[model samples]
Target: MSEIERLDLLEKTLGRILVAIGAADAKVAQLFAISTGMLGFEATIIAEIHSFSCFTFLFLALSALPLLFSLFSLFMVLYPRLDGPESVIYFYKIARKDIDCYLKQVGGITNSELMDDYARQSHRNAEIASAKFAWLRKANMSLFFATIPWLIVVLIGYAAV
Candidate 1:
């Protein structure tokens, strides 16, 4: 491929990685909202079951533990980790420079250097996106498991009332 075509390919790959990261972030936000709502829901249910029998309490604990774990996993997904080797394409690295310096450095880079930057950014971002997705999976699974015990707790709560 010509140098120009190779550059275009690298740009496309980087764009795809960035889009994947954006989707992962959006998923994390949605999961966060669900976790928040679940926490509020559990609080109300726990309050209603104030006179909890041992079974009720047991199920509540089971329900709560997984929910908390899911929330923690969601937090892991949202946590930012921007540390990496310096590159023109890495947001933090770029942001660390003053406007003139950033403009000069990016502007001064040759086609080959620009390709290197894009490739490094693509790899780094792919790693980040992969980790976020793994966390998202864990969060999703924990949330699902939480509902199972939570259902039992809710049913018992209703029976008690």
Candidate 2:
């Protein structure tokens, strides 16, 4: 395809990827908040229960450990996002600088070469971003499943007490 067409496609791809990243980041944040809040509440309940009975506290602690781990896994889920694909930003920065240089080149040349390079880098960055998100997505799913046992434990612990 022509440079202009390629650039257009690259821009669209970048936009879509950025949107996905934003959505996933928001979701991770939301789930983290919920998990932390629930964990906090459970800890408080266990503390209160402990005041009344050592046996109950021990039982609840046993049950709550997985939930705590689940929450830990949830925290782990954010690592990819925190690390994110630096290549994308790097490519964009390079492209911006190249673009400026291209504009200043002699004879008002429309540098299709740099545009091609930009397109290539953008495509590469998009791929890297996708792979990163795929891993993040898996981690998020694992976190979701992990919470199930925690919930069950919480319910059973409360019931037992």
State which candidate has the highest TM-score. Answer: 1
lDDT of 2 by residue, 1-161 (tens): 87678777777776776676566556666656665776776676554443345655554555456446555654554454332222323434435456656446423534465455446555664665665466556545544554655565466557656
Please give each candidate's TM-score. Answer: 0.90, 0.58
Model 1 alpha-carbon miss at residue 78, Å:
1.7
Tens-place lDDT digits, model 1, residues 1-161: 99999999999998999898888878877777887787777777777775767887788888888788888888888789788778987879988999999999988999999888888888888898899899889989988988878888778767656
State model 1's lDDT: 0.84
**Model 1 alpha-carbon drift over 4 Å, by segment:** none
lDDT of 2: 0.55
